[model samples]
Target chain A: MSASDYESASKGASSDVATFDDEEKGLFGRFHHALHATPALVPLIVLMVAIGIFAIVLGERFFSPGTLTLILQQVQIVGILALAQSLIILTAGIDLSVGAMAVFSSVIMGQFTFRYGLPPAVAVAAGLAIGTGIGAISGWLVSKVKLPPFIVTLGMWQIVLAANYLYSQNETIRSQDIRDEAALLQFMGIRFELGGAIITMGVVTMVVMVIVLAYMLRSTAWGRHVYAVGDDPEAAELAGVNRHRTIMSVYMLAGFICGIAGWIMIGRFGSVSPSASTGVVGNIQSITAVVIGGISLFGGRGSIWGAFFGALIVGVFELGLRMAGANAQWTYLLIGALIIGAVAVDQWIRKVTA
Target chain B: MSTEPILKARNLVKRYGKVVALNRCDFDLYPGEVLAVIGDNGAGKSTLIKALSGAIQPDAGEIWLEGKPIQLPSPIEARRHGIETVYQTLAMSPALSIADNMFMGREIRKPGWRGKLLKQLDRKEMERLARDKLNDLGLMTIQNINQAVETLSGGQRQGVAVARAAAFGSKVIILDEPTAALGVKESRKVLDLIQDVRSRGIPIILISHNMPHVFEVADRIHVHRLGSRLCVIDPKSHNMSDAVAYMTGAKEPDQHLETA
Candidate 1:
């Protein structure tokens, strides 16, 4: 059915429900009783349509396996990182330290593996610990100290940026001593051939992570807590939800994911450079992907899949600009315009719907 | 009805610095009855509700549930005792479906990740329960509980909130200004819902400024004046003017038998 038709039906059903007696209410009441029951099929459908349009425009080049694989590789780190930001945004909070945190943790990993001669697994763990520890501190400030997440994370962003610089001493780690794991980096970079389409391993991992996170947000009890805290903390508390614990958990989860993204970035670039990925593409792309995916910045209104689709939208837009021969500076300008446009449209839609 | 009061508050006091919001107030909620709290703005009506709901800790007070003294440290603690509150904003997410909002923070989950994917939210069960809850209060024309809350009219939204509290097994439902933003028809809908809740044996505390509503559903009208519950009068015995005069402290309570 059409969108308006479905809405009208819902409205009629709600009115009819007002006068019905308890025992008489039946099957219609069973399968579709949630207030947020409007399925997000529309956004998913729109994403697919956008992909089709891009494919048609890029023609043979976009349809090629090599190009598809390249896009996946290009977006892997930020795609996963954006998923992290989506969780924070879902709770009506922001983590400005995400990019810097990723860089800082990767620096730790570099130190562990290259400078201190630690195992890869140990280095990975060290990176995750650093990232998650910072996240815990930030979460504490937000929940316990009652600081705003935006300000807390913004300050952390600066701290982490400075720490990363100090930790690196303005030098790039170029040690080739760990040559035994060259294949490991290739493993992260490798692609599998399926039905004439090449999808990188990182792409598969990111897709799975996105689906899992989305499912967790939609189907789990913890997911409900996240939405509840975002919707109204006082009411959620009255309903027996642990608002502080959920908020902290969301921040910690975001940190853990960024940690993983850090390792993935190191693998992709073959080295860690302090200046190379500082604030990495401005974090604008990550935010853009999330908003474009249909997740509201206001929280309690979007999904993790929206973050995934948002990333693809960013990927497509970047590819489109390249195909159109736009200058390097225009890429940032385009993304900036898109972010503003998407947010404005979202506000407009909410007003109309409300 | 049990002999013991389901909920009680004594010597409840709250001060916002120097401003006394609630002063030495005492209140009780019995099983299977509707209690109407009437007062002008700044009469500490909201403050009393907040204290009862565990939104804030009272400076000096004791609460009891089922005859045992209790401490309402936070709202979560209040819900553990089966108290739910429907606020002025309805405490619902407009972007979500009605059933989702009703069952939020207490969602019915499947067994595992696989179950979550295959069985999902037991959506059918939640919807059935939601419908039954709504129907219990004579609110059953609603065909799709999956619809977003943004689509519903004001009365419908209020009704849905009442239904939500009922569905959650709230033994005492405190409604704060449920009809303030509504029109005449909508207000009547909410009043009927309160009565329906009372009929179901759940005590309801209806906080309203509308006297007609007070007389319509309230078994007892408790008037708050100058930071205290001046007096409680049976609706059947007191007229609107008598209640108002007492509420504003314009007329002293008449107790001919006592000398103070």
Candidate 2:
């Protein structure tokens, strides 16, 4: 029961005698412990190193304010989607339909305003509500029906994709029409010029979202419950956590975030195409960002900021390659390698701590 | 000790397919005493404890707490009735910090506006109380309350679980094999903690196979066999071999007035 008694007792129990003196560890052991203790550190270092490499290679172009702002603009959509994905991953679940849901929601917004004659503002709200509604369906299937998250979200992706095509009649809302009739539809695309960089409302929105979610996860009771459920649902339930409600809320919140992402997608493109090819890659891109950000695919680990950094890493690679006049295919190759590297590091951390 | 039992179960029956885990079992717990439920493997000791702790519902039974009939359909309901169970698994999240694990489900929020509007947790307060509880249980080896539970040794993990139960257990604490996984010194520490808990006037029901441990701390040993309570013996009057004999069905229990 006492400290001295516990030390002696534990020593007699196992032949591998290890003490709790963390300061006495070797350099490598200390580094391993630090990596396991703070998951964000690895990703943060990677981000910094990437920036340094790009800056050195591209010189004035990469370090310029305009290029930096462009990188922020490019990552906004995936960054938002990654935030949504992070919430699901934290609950030990996945959302394969994040991209489809965002695209479908965007199509709904455009069609509702232009075809259904609803006000642009009302159409936007309805689009967001529909995204949340679809998420509720996934959440119900996951929590109530007890289906695997991957399967449920996979099915939802196809269904939502098909619905987007059928409902819009394969129509593409032109930017000219949107500008002539409902200019507010492209409101988030509006940018203000700072000292040398132009910052869009979409990028600002992404920043605000990351900050709010980070605070929520770090400083709230609900945040702790989310981590608890991810760590062990049975233990969380025994400790008085409502596992069903927690999981359901996480799904619903992710859906709502995806809806916001959809709105940003519209602003980013200045057009709504039912067949937006990017919709197919949205889920993968978001997941990639989350994984590379040092957030555990298994859940109950990593920081929301890490996911943001992960998205930026992708953006940096894309822009850095383009500016350096490298083949576009190289971006994909590097990103693929980075994803593997991140997961390997995650495994190493888990092994050391475990 | 109070003449009337604080908690009692009557004719508890639980069936798992063809296997009858508990066949009309009955049990009782007096106030301010450590009652050890000991038996052979698969002798329904765990099943009986599960039914009592609200982890599993009995097919047909009635459980009385403080002389009142209570329905324990879930662990949350059990806690509401001032009953807490520390399972053999310990039931603490391995990746979560000790303070976070301690306040997993029942986290305290910041006072006034911050709690109401922002829904912020009172981390400082929770950490302070967690340290105090660990110290009260004489488990001060934990240098940081924010360290994850996985970093702790088996004995330390057990200490955290017991501390959590002791901090919140208002009426009765039920421990299922609390020391089954621990070593000699760790087991001794746990026995000391059990005695410490009893001194606080909280009755304990400890289900363990270690007869020496049972005899060391149990005021009365409840011998379980074949899905039912065989008998309850005063540890002072009966020895370990007698308890083991009754548990293994080698010896028949003497006819005595039912304690309940």
Candidate 3:
């Protein structure tokens, strides 16, 4: 048969079935379809709604340039960590040790510079290296040993947390000592005024990191491989993707980003303490941002930009709640609701798309 | 027609624990011909193709391409030898665009510093080529090259998979039941595509249970029965009932007939 003949036959066959194009769909169906097509839309809309409500309630306090910038500043650490978590999650994997790794690396930087008397720059590099090394171990376990990412990272989190305490002897690097000895450690905290808004170097770093990663994931072959692996590893492998290598690279990259977050953490707090209490919540917080960002926990969908907006939403909620004199627990309650709502939206979208 | 077979497999044996999937099976393909492999369910049709396509390594076998013995320990290795297999699953990522799925593992990088340093993919080039390949195969129903595979119909997805194989398969293409999940019209489109591919002079191995499709497009049909080849019959010489009888062990091949 000729191609046109087959085409006509196919057309006839398809006409037998009831077809519902996007335009023919009702309001809810269209909305669900749109959500599936553009993952960042829901999160972006939620962010706008949150901003509008908080701006109305808090009035001047929420709308003030300083308060808005303060939200950005407060979100810098978790935002950066969320970027790391986002990469791992994009590959259908999770890294529960991101916060511990950052804290551990920060402790290494402080202790190396003060006790070991290493140069500040060298100490920072060492901290970054240690973060990547630990990440490589996690990747090896995940890709080579075939261990679940969740289990491997969970174990790594505890191990790194313990190591941080033992290696630092539960000591806190005094902010004064860091300022006097390693002034560069405070570089990320440096800020400049721009149009009535205060912008810190840490915020710039976070923005740049997100932009670069978003571009890479959208345009690069390596980024495509990451998505491919997450979408379906067996299909990816048959199509010639190195599944193990892709999985491993994602873990290592997440680790490297977490290491950068560690440097930013030092700048944000100005002190590195080997305390489990403060850093223990890091994993959950980053995960919360990712979940709210509309990045599918199942992977192969969503964007880094969505995760960024997700982090910003949390920042807005926290500041808005404080300014409105609401109880702190209310923030958690609202965030919990958002997480559940976002996942429900995700499921709905999947059903419609599928 | 070339006298030498483009691909030849000898004494292939594969066993899964207690069950033997392929028992010393031998197979061959000539250049510029459509060879169809047909069998009952679980008759080791897929297993034999897997061995040839390098998805599985036979316990004892030798595969020859262009008259030279070659070892294909992996699917990637098979591709290197210009043997591409369009798996039953289609093996294309549904979330990615058609162009991305076409060049999933073998992406074309841009030339110069942007490609090397930044690892930038030549996406426009890939999309253009993907469009050309689809059009060349008369699979141009898809207007957008950037549409995700998930949005396409089952036949279109299969078209993309076949197009990928045809685009890259320089010597041999193996398709495992390309029309199994497709509708009648879609199956016709695929059969036409197989004829188009054969006219291009690249040999094809089509595995199917559809007797009419196999008879319509195949130059020769290999009847697989009980993990071994019962006979290789030319469509002009044997009828469908004869082939079916041989496949079901109700008839035996003439002793004078060639085995491989």
Candidate 4:
């Protein structure tokens, strides 16, 4: 076979796949394609339906602006934490230390302000630095030390939890004291009325975090690298992506976000307490939001907006159930079903490898 | 043919836990030539490819690219010097869009303040380039440019992978078992793709065990036996049996055939 023969024989020989990209037929295929295109849709639809159901059942009680705005306020902290978790999860890694890291940073802020007599702003900065530095340690362990992310963050969870207890000596910083001395500590508690809903600054912060992080993940090279690294680390490496640097940077950025979550913790509770439920309930709840929101647990195949919608779904369930006079515990049972259902649907959608 | 080799390897020795995988193996790839490396399983052919592609560091070897000795300690480093490899797995991120997979590591940023200050990706430009490259291979039949790679058939995925290598691989392109898992029709497409790449004047190092495919497409075949290059035989002058015999240690290559 001469080179000229190859050219003659090769002409017009396209092995184009016949079934490629034919508009998926039938409801199942169309739904799969739809879910594939917009991962956040599942949670969004679930959220809308849950709200509609409660509005019909509870009438004016559920449809009121107070109840609706309160749901957003309640999920705001978890929403911020989910943003941090989504960053790690997108890399196919989980950060079990999110709540512990946030609470620990808040404790550090209190100590810096009261014990050291530092200004509230300076103390808050120190807290942010500590949170980021601790996250960097976890990143170093995962990237350089070659440790599994789950194990590194699991061990970090315990260590940071213990440190929070020891450092704060179980002291609670009162809201009055924060108001008199370090007013900046309670900054996110400030509220304003908007379109019939009373919106807290904390809710605004969470919304801003989601919008900004979503933009970063969608529009930047670093964002693409995150998906690549999560989708297939080995493949990403072969394509010239610095896997270590990317992983390290993700952990560090997650940590910085967790730090802000800590600052907002103070505003949400009106006090700095080591025993805040953010540390205890935050880890599981944020993960719950991420899962229900439609982000795959396996990594690299979800949207950050899915997580926000996920948190909103839980919020709707909680507020709706309470208004309907049903046990709030029913919210857990339904959410448990949603998480498993989301994963199953994700698996089904993932089979579109035609 | 030019006197200088475009890519050259000498005395590449790699040992894994007291087992010598590549024992002083030598290889040469000339400019614009299809150099097929044929060997039995465990003949160190893959180890040789890995060393050349920088997938693994050779304990001792000198790799010369266009007459300059270079150290290839990693796959990323090899790609830096215009050496692209399409692995047996195709090494693609299946969930990403076609343009995203092609520009996985090197993404073009948007222009002006949005790009310079915000570090935003210029997705439109990348999609245009990806479409152009695929079209160059006459593979523009697939309509959607943003469709995920997983949705494409096996042949189309391999086509995208090949187009990617041809687009960015400024010097050498290596394809490992490109048609191993393909049907006859798909294999024909890949064979055509190889010839097309060679027609574009880029040298290719094809690693395969299939004799017919190798003989049909390769200009020169390098036989590997006992962890080293037995000889380099010209496919134009030799037949399949002689090449297989040399590789399996049943026949010794003549001195004239060795230097071709």
Q: Chain A: TM-score in each candidate?
A: 0.83, 0.93, 0.93, 0.94
Worst 10 residues of 4 chain B by lDDT: B251-260
Off-target runs (Cα >4 Å) in candidate 2 are: A1-29, B257-260
Q: Please report, as a residue range, the 10-residue window in candidate 4 chain A with the lowest summed lDDT.
A: A1-10
Residues A1-354 of candidate 1 have per-residue lDDT tens digits of: 121232233443334324536455355443223212432333455557756876897787776767766777778887988898888888888878888888887788777776777777788788889888888888889988989989999899889889888887866776353335433432454557876677777788798999888777776678877887776676566656788899889988888888777777666777777775636563555777787666778787777876776677677667766876778677678667767766765665555232
Q: Which order, best to worst by DockQ?
A: 3, 2, 4, 1
Rank list by TM-score: 4, 2, 3, 1
RMSD of each: 7.1, 3.2, 3.0, 2.6
lDDT of 3: 0.89
Candidate 3 residue lDDT tens string, A76-176: 98999999999999888998999999999899889999998999999989998998889999999988998998999999999999999999999999888
Q: Which residue ranges in model 3 land beyond 4 Å of their true spot? A: A1-34, A276-278
Worst 10 residues of 1 chain A by lDDT: A30-39
Which residue pairs collide, candidate 2? Answer: none
lDDT values, one for every candidate: 0.75, 0.89, 0.89, 0.89
Q: What is the TM-score of chain A in candidate 3?
A: 0.93
lDDT of 2 by residue, A1-354 (tens): 132343553554553334567666778888888888888888889989998999998898898899999999999999999999999998889999999999999998999999989999999998889999999999999988999999999999999999999999999999899988888788889899999998999999999999999999889988888887888888888887888998988888898888888898889999999787657999999999999999997878888999999999999999999999999999999999999999999989888554
Quick one: ranking by lDDT, best first? Answer: 3, 2, 4, 1
- DockQ in order: 0.33, 0.53, 0.54, 0.48
